[model samples]
Each structure stands twice: as C-alpha cells, then as structure tokens.
Target: MAGKQALNIVKIKKMKQDANPITVITAYDYPSAKLAEEAGIDMILVGDSLGNVVLGYDSTVPVTLDDMVYHSRAVARGAEHTFIVTDLPFMTYHGSLDETFRNVRRLMQEGHAHAVKMEGGAEIAPTVHSIVQAGVPVLGHIGLTPQSVNQIGGYRIQGKDEKDARRLIEDAKALERAGVFAIVLELVTEEVSAAISAEISIPTIGIGAGRGCDGQVLVFHDVLKYTSDYREKRFVKTYANIGEQIRNGISEYVNEVKTRAFPAEVHVFAAEEGVIDQLYGKGKAESES
Candidate 1:
C-alpha cells in the first residue's frame, strides 16, 4: 500500500474548500494510532476521552496534562503522516494564559503533537489566538464542550433553541477569527451545526452534531467494540464487535489449558536424542566424581 501523505493546516484547509469530508478518529496508543493511519484516517486526535476509555475514569475532567503527553507521544511514534491533534486537558488551558501556553507547548514539544484542541467559544478565543501567535496550530471545540459538563448540566445536545443556535454560530465565527485551523462541534443540533459550518471558513468536525459538517470524528473504541461496558450512544455505529471476539478467544484458551490441549507437541521445543543422552551422561559422570 502507498504511504499516507503528510497532513497539515494547508492540506486540511484545501479539503474544506473542496468540500471533501475529512475523517478523524481518537487513538491513545501506538497500536491504535497505527491502525487508524493504516485505515487512511485523516486525523488522529489524542483526546482526553482516554480518561474514560483507557484509564477507567468516568469523565475527562480527571485527566491530567501528563496523561495527555504520555499517550500523545505513543500515538506520534505510530502515526507517520496522519495529523496528530492532542487535547489540552481540563484546567490545563482554563488557567492563566501563561499556564495555557506552557501546557500547549508541552503537547507540541514533549508530546510531539501536530496541533492542540481546546474546548470553549468566544470566551477562550483570546487564548486560542495567543497559542496560534506562538506558532502552534489550534483546533477549537465548541457546542457540548466536555470539560464544562458540570456547567452544561450533562452531555446533552447544545444549541437547541434559536437564541443558543445564534450563539453557537457566533462562537464558531469567533474561533475562526481567532486563527483556529479547524473546529469540532460535539453533540450539537444538526441545523445549528450546519449553520456554524457554513459560517466558519475553517473545517467543522462533528462528533454527534449530524451530517452537515465538513468532517466527522469518532472515538476508536466506539467504532470497534473495544469495550462492552460502555452504554450505546446515538452517534456511535459500531463497525465490529471485537470485544465479543476477544471474550470468545479468551474462553477458548481457558478451555484448552484446562483440558491440557495447549502446549501439545507442536507448541513445545524438542531436543535431539543424542544431545539429551550426552547431557545425562555428563550428569552421571559428575555424580560419580
């Protein structure tokens, strides 16, 4: 197979202009990143969703910057050409501007991320601009920002009413003006998300925000049945039931071991009869001495 072409801000912008739908998937480790790249995915987001998916956390708020950096580096090693965008975890960017810059820099320099994504709208535009000014690409995330789940009162669809829809559109515009290369709209009303995508010059990557987006993103675990514990979401279309297959395979292995069917001749290393006899003879001589 031909190697994937390197993706950058220029290429992504061109894709939006050409009306091509971009593909993005979350990957937290080397194997996941390699698989995503092999599948011709356009972008790999090292999302703080890892907190819930990988680390057994209930929400993204508990994820630290260090956790993001560690996973981002692992993903970077596996993805050669696919664009890597890592999330600036909660509180990392919500603090002072200097703190935001520091955290973003760590993601870029230490984590080897190509871009950084942060949640918010007009309120965080200034920080987005500052990060862009420092020569780091920013991907703005609006609508149902997970970091503010407490403030938003849970993972509900945003911009439902006319007033809030207008606000979402304004936020997308503001983020574009602030110099974000792209924006991610999560759990937003379809009409409002389409309007925001239309108003913004940059690409709009939707999670649960419907089909009117310039692109779409889904968690890797959601796409493949990596875990059976998660509650099904409206947006997730599971392509494979890998979790079931894994469980079945493990059960087979357990049965084989219990029956002593495993490590049957083919699984064992054999020794030459002559070599075995020579070793036994040597032991006999040593005992006699």
Candidate 2:
C-alpha cells in the first residue's frame, strides 16, 4: 500500500511553467485510484461524471455534495502520491458564502481531497476567492461546464464564434486572477483552447478540448473500455477492451460449470477411507435410532 503523501501543487505549477504537459485521469473508487497511482498518473479527479459513469444518472446535475465526498474519500484512500482534485457537485457553492465554506471544508476535511474544482467563471470568482482564503485550493472550470448543460442548451462545443471565444478568454483570465491553481477547459475549440493555454499563467487541463492544453484528462472508464454500454465520444480513445475480456472470462466460467469441469480432483478436499466409512456408519446409526 502506498503512503498518504499528496502531490504538491507547486510541482504541477512548475510543470506548466516548464511546458511539460501534465496527465490527469478520473477515478471513482479504490481499485481505479490504486491502478492510477501504480501507473504513476500525475493527478486524479473524483469527478461528478461519476453520476453518468458510475451512478447511472443521465447528467451530472443529479449528483450531490454527499456523493462527491463519498467517492472522493475512496479515491483519496487509494491514491498516495498523486494529486486528488474533487468536484463540488451542482448547487453546493452557488449560494451563500457560509454555505460554500461549509461544503468546501467538508470536501477537504472529510473527503481528504487535495483540491476542489468548481464550475462557472467571473460569477463564482468571489466564492473561489473565499475558499482559497480559507486555505483550500480551488481549480476553476469553464467552457462547457456540465452543471450548466441545461442552461447552455446541451453538451456542445464552446468558444466557437469570436464573441464566445473572447468571453472564454476573459473567463480564464478571471479565474487565474481569482487564484485558481489550474483551469479545466472542456469541449472548447482547439484554437480557443490553445489561445487560453498561451494566455494563462496557470495550467489549462483539457478534456475534449484538443492537445494544445498544458495537460489532458479523461475518465478511467473511457480509457479502459470498462463497459459495453458506454457511448463512444470523439475525444475518447479506447486503449484496452477490458469489458470484452471480462465478458469472455465470465462466459468460460459459465460453460465450465455447465460441463462440470471446473471443480476437478485437485480442487476438492480429501480424507482417509476409514474416516469416510466411520462418517457413513455414524449417519446410518443415527437414522436407525
């Protein structure tokens, strides 16, 4: 088991400054987090995308603060060195500053996350500042924030036109000003993403936003092909079809059971013939009595 020393934010900052692209992946449970740590991944996000990938919800809005805390704690326990960033689920930070502080504190103290990520731009900058002042690191998220999917109309690419692109650039700058360690650019145009990466002093972590970012992030389930029901997205590249392998392995077990070939002599326990005969005699005596 790995020890519980979290990755330093300074290292990630230096990586961005040195132009060394960072790598981040989402892990929802202990097994996934442990595997990511063993693989030496740079960061692990206990994203609310867990709702879609793990909890069977159609959208992230259905996720709650309690849900994030539960999964974040599991990931934190498994990941020792890798930096852990957990999402503040929808509506957790959008209300009063006291409410935001309470929830963010719970995520850090209870969930054991190194950092917390929240959506929105300038509108939430004050909340971001408050959290940072309270000694919690904040990772700002803009450009196709999933929590805003209903308001934005759907899961479409952001920063397409000049007006939207300009606003995105401003949002990134605002978040950087608000003291966010990094920003997640999701479903933005490549040109816009590259521009923001160039403009921002902090790192830009991209998801479905092309390769020009300071780092790239993807869900573990998508990378490992963990399920056959998962929808393939343009940005997702399936590395290993573990789902198919699992299916085949289970089928083999089923066939072996049907054929009575699984539990061979080597799989059974043995006793002396005299002991077996004594057991049989005891049973006969009891029945006769």
Candidate 3:
C-alpha cells in the first residue's frame, strides 16, 4: 500500500470492510497526484473533471479520450499507490453501445486506469455490462451527471422527487447488476443516497450526496483550494488552503528576485577550486560564496 504497486483489490476490499468511507480526489497530473498520494488520500481519480479543473474548459463535453489518456498516464505515474480511475469522455461511450467496448479497452490499455467510470444508469446498463463482460472493472456514476449537464440544465440536486428517487435507486441496482466495483452518486439526496448504499452490495462512493455514502470523492483542486474563484459546493470540505500557500511562495520568490536577495547560501551550488580559477580570478569565489 505504501509502494509502487497502485491501489489493489486487497486495499479496496479492506476499505469496504472498514466502513470508514474511503475518500477519493481527482488528480490530473504527476505533481498533483503525487501530492495526493503523499497526503495519504485513499484514491486518485484522473477524472474528466480535468476539463474544467486542469484544461480550463466550461464543461466535460470538450474533454477528449486523448486528453483523458494523457493526463491519466501522468497521474498513474504519481498515484502509484492510490486507486486511479479515469472517466470515459463524451461521445466515446454514449455515442454507440458497441463503441463503448472499444473506447473502454483503449482507456485501460492505453490510459493505464485501473477502471473506467461513466454516468447514467439503466440507459447505460448494457454498455456497462458489456465492458464488465470484457473483463474491465467499471464504476457507475449516477445523480447529477456532468456529461449530460445540458440535458440536466446545469448542476442541480437529484433524487428529491419520488419519481427521480426511484429512478436513482433502479439506476443503482442496474449498475450493481452489471458488476461495477463501486458507484459514484453525485449531487443526489442524502437520504436517497443512504438507501442506495444500504441496498447495493458493492461500494457506493458519493460526492454532494452527504455522509451517508460508503465513501466520498472530491476534485483535488477543490479540496486543495486551487480553484478559489469557483463556487464552493455543499459537499466540498476543504482540508487545506494550498492555493494560498503556493501563491505566497511564488510571490515571495518574485520579491526575493526583485530585491536581489535570493540565492541564499544553502540554495547556491559550489564549484571546484581549479574550475572556479579557470572560470574567473580569485574574486569570483569570494563574491559567489
């Protein structure tokens, strides 16, 4: 769990047995994922959330399979211990049911994601079923799915009404039947989320679905305070203001350079006596040292 072997079934099984609710964060690159790994986060999702968080896009619709693959590979390099899951971007899966198999294989084989996640339930069950049948682990996503944000009319809470709530439950069951290792319930009612968690045999990891879920996941940027300008959501519990720290550090560095006060002794390199003599007279050593 502490080494190069990425998150494995043993860890996931123990995670399920512990009942402590695993915490997952979206990490788009090596540095961010390395930070998440060092911070002891339970999982790393190379999410298409990167469209907004990393690529500065308005929505996940613009995120492509190649974009996800490139970032997932970078994240996989750093989050060697944390479970790394990548999203199947728009059109790749929803375009055609048969195409889902081809795209999912490319994700696992090329992107290096342990599993793939897709939004929707009963409507996407056959696709999910086929992927699992082909031996790829699938994680189901329900509730306020981002890929269908246009159809859903912006990010909003789901499963509040009886019809929507029942549909959410049936969607969970459908995904469970299709053999997903876990399900992500985002922006759904907490009570409904609890019911689904209770009913489902596999793990239910939630975001904006409240504490009743078997686990919770958040985008790394949101959790780390990287997107300070973005609206804070009810589900995001920021653990640190790393963005501020990063900004301050950069600012201090700029100030140091501006004042010519940087290159502190410990930060500067040393040269051999003859090398220094060859490069300059004796005064260079005195001033540099």
Error of 2 at 98 (Å): 1.2
Candidate number with the higher TM-score (2 or 3): 2
Cα deviation of 129, candidate 1, in Å? 0.4
Q: Number of the top candidate by TM-score?
A: 1
Pairs clashing within candidate 3: none
Which candidate has the top score in lDDT?
Answer: 1
Error of 1 at 175 (Å): 0.6
Residue-level lDDT of model 2, residues 1-289, one tens digit each, is 3554556778888899998898899999999999999887889999999999999999999999899999999998888677999999999998899988899988999999999999999888888988888888898899999999999999999999999999999999988988899999999999999999999889999999998999999999999999868688999897999989989999999999899998888899877656844877656745676
lDDT of 3 by residue, 1-289 (tens): 3654556645674676778668788889999988888888877888888999878899999999999889998988887777788999987887676777778878888888899988889998888888888888888899999999999999999999999999999999999898788899999999999999989877889999987888889888788788647677777888788888888999999999899889788889877657876778757877888
lDDT of 2 at 5: 52
Q: How many steric overlaps are in each model, in order? A: 0, 0, 0
State residue 128's C-alpha deviation in candidate 1, in Å. Answer: 0.5
Off by over 4 Å in 1: 280-289
Give the C-alpha lDDT of model 1. 0.92
Q: How close is candidate 1 to the true structure, as a TM-score?
A: 0.95
lDDT of 1 at 197: 83
Per-residue lDDT of 73 in model 1:
98
Error of 1 at 288 (Å): 19
